[model samples]
Target: MAWAGGQVNNPTQADAMKSRLQAIEQDLSKNWEKRDELNRTAERASTELKEIQERGIGLARSLYRYSAKADSLQTRLQQMQERERSKSAAMARRQGQLAATLSALQRMARMPAATLVAIPQPPQNTIRSAILLRATVPKLKDEATRLADELRTLKALRANIAGDSKSLAKTMADLEKERLSLSFLTAKKMRLLEKTRSAEHSAATRTARLSARAGNMRELLWALLKQKQSPELRGEDFEPPPAAGKPETATAEPPTPPRQTAALAPFRLPRGPIPALGRIVTAFGAKMPNGTLSKGVYISTRPSAPVVAPTKGRVMFAGVFRGYGNLVILELPNKDHVLISGMAKISAEIGDEVLAGEPLGEMAPSTSSLPKLYFELRRQGRPINPLPPKAARRNKVRG
Candidate 1:
C-alpha cells in the first residue's frame, strides 16, 4: 500500500502566503477607510474654522463700533457735566439776588417797629399794607421752590447720562474679550486641521508602500507559477529555463531600437453625465478569496446605466464567462483587449465597433442589491494596469 502520510501535502508555504496577503489587504482597507474619514473630518474642521473666523471678524467690527459708541457717550456726558457746572454758577447768582431781596423785605418789616421807637415816619399799619406784604412773601417762596425743582431735574439728567456711559463701556469690553477668545479657538482649529492632513499623508505613504510590496509579491508568484508550468519541470519538482540569446559559451550585447512615445493629455468629461454611475465596491487588483488576483476594477451600477468604453475598441466577446457574469470583451486596434463583465443586459453585438466613452448597455441589479461591473485592460492576453500612461518608463542605465 502507498504511504498515506507521504501522500498528504503539507500546505505550510501556501498558508503562510495566504495569511500574508490577507494581512496586507486588511491593512490596505483599513488605511483607505481611515484616509476617507480623516479627509472628511479635516474638511469639517476647516469649514467650522472658517465660519468661526468670519463670525469673529464680524464680532471684532461690532466691538469696534460699540467702543466708538462708548466714546461718543462719554463725550456727551462730559459736555453735560460742563453744562451742569455752568447752570450751577448761574443758579448761585440768582439765589444771591433772591437772598438780598428777602433780606430787604425783612428789614422793611422791622422798619415800622424801628420808626415807632425812634420817632421816625409812622409805620403803614393798615390792613391793605399787611395783605400786600403777605402776598409778596408767598411769591418769593414760590420762586425759590421753582428754582430747587429745576436743579433736581438737571442733576438727575446728568446722573442718568453718566450711568449709561459706564454701562456701554462695560459692554464693549466684554465683546472684546469674546472676540479674543474666538481668535484663539480659530487658530487651534487650523492647527488641528493641519495635523489631520499630515496624518493622512503619512497613512497614504504607508498604503503606497504596501501596495508596491504586494505588486512585487504577486509578480514573483506568477513567475514561479510559470516556472512550475514549464515542460522542463517534473511532476513534483520545478526547474528554470536557460537564459535567452546567450550562447552555450559566449554572450553579446546590441543597441536597442528607438522607443515610441505617447502623451496622455487631460480629457474633458461631459457635465452632468457620468461615464459610469456606480459605487466602486471592490478595489482594483484586490486578492480573491481563493488566493488569486481579482485583476480589475469593480463598479456597482444600476441596470439601466450604460457602461461606456474608456477608450475606442471593438467588441471581442459578449457572452457569459466562468466568473464574469454576462461579460463583454473589447480588443482595440493596438492589440489591447479590455474586459467588462457583470452585466444584466447587452446592447452592442459581438465584433461591433465602439467609440471611446460610448454607452455600452444597460446594467441590472446585482444579487448584493449593488450592481457591479468588473473591468480590465490587457495586452497580449496578460493583464495590464491602465493607469494615466502619460509618461513612458524608459531604461536609463546609460547607452
Candidate 2:
C-alpha cells in the first residue's frame, strides 16, 4: 500500500513541477516578445524623428538664405530711392529753366517784328541777333524733351523696385510660416519619444522586478524539495475533497489575486521632449579605439541649433566639466538626472527650474559639418542603457 501511494504522489508532484516550469518559460517568452515589439516601435520613431529633423534643418537654412537675399534687395532699393530723389531735384531745375525761357519768349512776342526793326539803328547786327535767338530756342526745346524721357525712366525703375519689395515681403512671410510649422512638428515628435520611453521604462522595471521575485520563489521551492526532513505542506497546497453531489471535474477553483512585490513601487516622472534635433552619431556603451566604453551618446546637429530642456527639472550644474564642454545637468523630480554637454553656450543657470522645451543654449560652432553633442540619462548615480532592447542587443553583439 505504501509503495502504490508513493508512486501516485510522485507522478503528481513531478507533473506539478513540470507545469510550473512551462508556465515560467511562457512568461519569459512573452516578456521578450513585448520587449522586441517595443524596440521595433522605438526604431521606427527614431527614423521618423531623424527625417523630421532634417526637414526642419532644411527649412532653417532656406530661411537664412532668403533673409540674406531680402537684405540685399532692401539695400538696392534704398540706393534706388536716393537716385529718385536726385532725379526729382534735376527735374525741378529743368522746369525752372523751361519757365524762364517761356517768360522771355512771351515778352519778345508782345513786341511786333516790325517795331523792333524800326527801333534798331543797325539792321545787320539786329538780323544776326534774330538768327542767334532762333537757334537757342530749338536747343532749349531738345534739352527739355531729353529731361522728360529721363524722368519717365526713373519713375519706371522706382515702380519695379516697389513691386520687387512687395514680392519679397510675401516670400518671407510664407517661409516664416513654413519654418514655424516644421518647428511644431519637430516638437510633437520629441514629445512622443519622451512618452514612449517613459512608458517602456516603467513596464520594463515592473517586469524585471517580477522576474526576480519569481526566481526567488523557484529557489525556495527547490530548497524545500531538497531538504531531508518532510515538511508539512500548507493547507493552501491541497484541493478540498470533491462535494458529495458534484463530480470533481465540475468543481471550479477560485482564482487568486496577483502578488505584488516591493520592487513594483511606482514613482512620478516628468514627460518631455528631446533637447535638440539631430542624428545619433554614437550610441551608449560603444567601445572606443582607446579600449574605453562610452557612457553616453553623441548627437550630430546643425550649427547654432537650439538645445532645449528634456523635462521639467532644476539645473544642478551649468558649466564646463572636464572632457565635456558647456555642460548642463538637470535633476528630475524622481531624482533621475540627465546631462547635456558639448554646447556652444549655456543659457540656464544653476538652481534654475527649467520647463520642458525651454532653450538651454545654442550648439557650439553651429557651422560644423558634424556638430556633435553628448547626452546621458542616469538613475541613482548609475547610467543605464537608454536605447531600446533590440538596438542594445545588436550593439552588444557588434561590439
- Judged by whole-model lDDT over C-alpha atoms, candidate 1 comes out at 0.52
Across 90-127, the per-residue lDDT of candidate 1 in tens digits comes to: 88988998898788678667777445455543455544
- Lowest-scoring 10 consecutive residues by lDDT in candidate 1? 390-399
Highest lDDT: which candidate?
2
Tens digit per residue, CA lDDT, model 2, 1-399: 124744645767778878999999999999999999989988987777666545644554454445445556767878888888888888888889888877877777698888878964798887776777677798888987998798888889889888878977886676567546645765675576565555334432332233233222222222222221333333223222222342112111112212111111211111112465555667677776777666666777555555666656776566654566677877777655677888887766654556555556667554437577777665444454443334333321100
Error (Å) of candidate 2 at residue 158 is: 2.3
TM-score of model 1 vs. true structure: 0.38
User: Estimated TM-score per prediction?
Assistant: 0.38, 0.46
Clash pairs for candidate 2:
303-366, 304-366, 344-364
Q: What are the runs in model 1 whose C-alpha is more than 4 Å off? A: 1-11, 113-153, 169-177, 180-187, 190-399
